[model samples]
Target: MKLTKIALLLSAATLLPNLASAGTLEQVVKKGALNCGVSTGIPGFSATDSKGAWEGLDVDFCRSVAAAVFADADAVKFIPLTAKERFTALQSGEIDVLARSSTWTSSRDTSLGLNFTGVNYYDGQGFLVNKKLGVSSAKELNGATFCIQAGTTTELNLTDYFKANGMEYKAVTYDTSGQTIDGFKKGRCDAVTSDASQLYGLKLKMDDPNSVMVLPEIISKEPLGPVVRQGDDDWFNIVRWTLYASLEAEELGVTQANVDMQLKSENPSIKRLLGTTGTAGKDLGLKADWAYNIIKKVGNYSESFDKHVGKDSPLGIDRGLNKLWTQGGLMYSMPIR
Candidate 1:
């Protein structure tokens, strides 16, 4: 289900506009829309609603940056991309930032001309299969046909996981998660391979979720996060810290519901994070209330996660490895100052 070559060519053409002489922050401001690259569809992380408007965890990342820069979360134009096209789109300057669920990897770091801002989702690859297949473990799927998204580590990881486990499986590669899931549901693949968090999102979207079982084998490390072109250190810092601010806000006990009250906190960390203690935002070329705009408008990471992908949502994914370092998870925010 890879996007046809023609589509990629068209994407390239669309992205061929002369790169602005200024940094990405200026381009975003001038264009009046923070062009964002997002997944084709992954419930709770990035998905289109019934009304065709995008909303999810990843979507909020883009919105938070928009809010910090433009003081409005809604000033974003999302470009939905297949995994195959996402890196190319970003590399070609088609989008100011990519809020897609992309796993950070060494090759991507050097070859893609992109910078992973930070790990928004600490994850590992996993398997999902029809319960009727009676597959208890990944080791048992020696002859399985794995449906995987192409141009992603998931594809190579699928091959590597099976090889490392001393098993053999064929792979049916797709550019989009929707195509992979649809193929899997139609019995075209024995298993669907992707990040575990994504497995949770896709499983909930399946027709017979109860019958679709995600295996317990946690395969490769997959730290899904945002990415941007490799240039303009200042612009990169703005994007990087915007993500950190959300995590820091959560760590410092700031939330959308309490941001207004937390502004006057005596705690130095809280004060700095909320723009009450210094001109940190100005140093980043953003308004003094840049972080405040994010927290007050977009909420903290925990708040967004709970609303979009937590216990109450249909995806219902446990925070697990994505929880803050204070909670014993890998999530750790950098100091704002």
Candidate 2:
């Protein structure tokens, strides 16, 4: 019996760390608000208006998670972070989830003690230059001074792309996207390099947005997504499914305005996603209507995209690779059931 007790004790001890790791949901519930990390400012991604209200694609995502948990999208407290500060804020528990436009790379996923929920945006590195530079292609950028944000995948990609082409350019690094754009505007650099999606967003911030143009060269693949700290499967599921729910909603023709009617959907996939016929949310330690709340309050992925960064928005970006997998794009969700 002594041996039996020892074996049981060892088993219990082995489970303790996992139990502790899964406590993020409980802590968030007790706190009554979800702390979401986002970019300091990036138009159409994460940015503050003149009235200090935050609204953007990333901000909407943070709100979506809050809606899934609290059924109140406004229950999120947005914590603005820079590229250098984003991971540390998540690691130190200063934020419950990092919804910033963070890239999912091997090192960031494994070496940083973080887990990327999934890619929300598929981007590629590109360059932005003033129209007067007569640079229609990135190849024309040889010997140009490029303004770039420090501590980003864009930095390394820029270096790699230039060297691969046997081209030479000087880099003027800034700590923030705003500063990078400012440096470019002030003629501190001849061009600015970043993700193509970001280059579109940043252009809107320029005094003469029409005067700037993103070149036709894309250098690197950047799968941008939300991130959570490692060691918490429950929290990871919550964040992951929140995004997938949005994607699935769009694919199933569910929208913020039609979610209530979708609750009565007869299609199996729609029923399962809206929680009328499955325990998808309950399995994640949330109410059965968690995904329903996200769709209704924060909208589906396409809705968020169209509103924030697509044709209807100032950014006017196409859905290209961000479209559903069925529509010749890469966005796909796991089966809800």
- Most TM-score-accurate candidate: 2
Candidate 1 residue spans exceeding 4 A from truth: 1-22
Mark the 10 consecutive residues where model 2 has the least summed lDDT.
Answer: 14-23
Clashes found in each candidate (C-alpha, N, C closer than 3 A) = 0, 0
Q: What is the lDDT of residue 47 in candidate 1?
A: 93
- Model 1 lDDT tens row, 73-188: 99999999988889888877888899888988898887756789898888899999889999788899999898888888887787787788788889888878988899998889
Clashing pairs in 2: none
Q: Candidate 2 lDDT, tens digit per residue, 56-151?
A: 889999999999999999999999998999999988889999998999999999887789999999989999999999979999889999999998
Local distance difference test, each candidate: 0.87, 0.92
RMSD of 1: 7.0
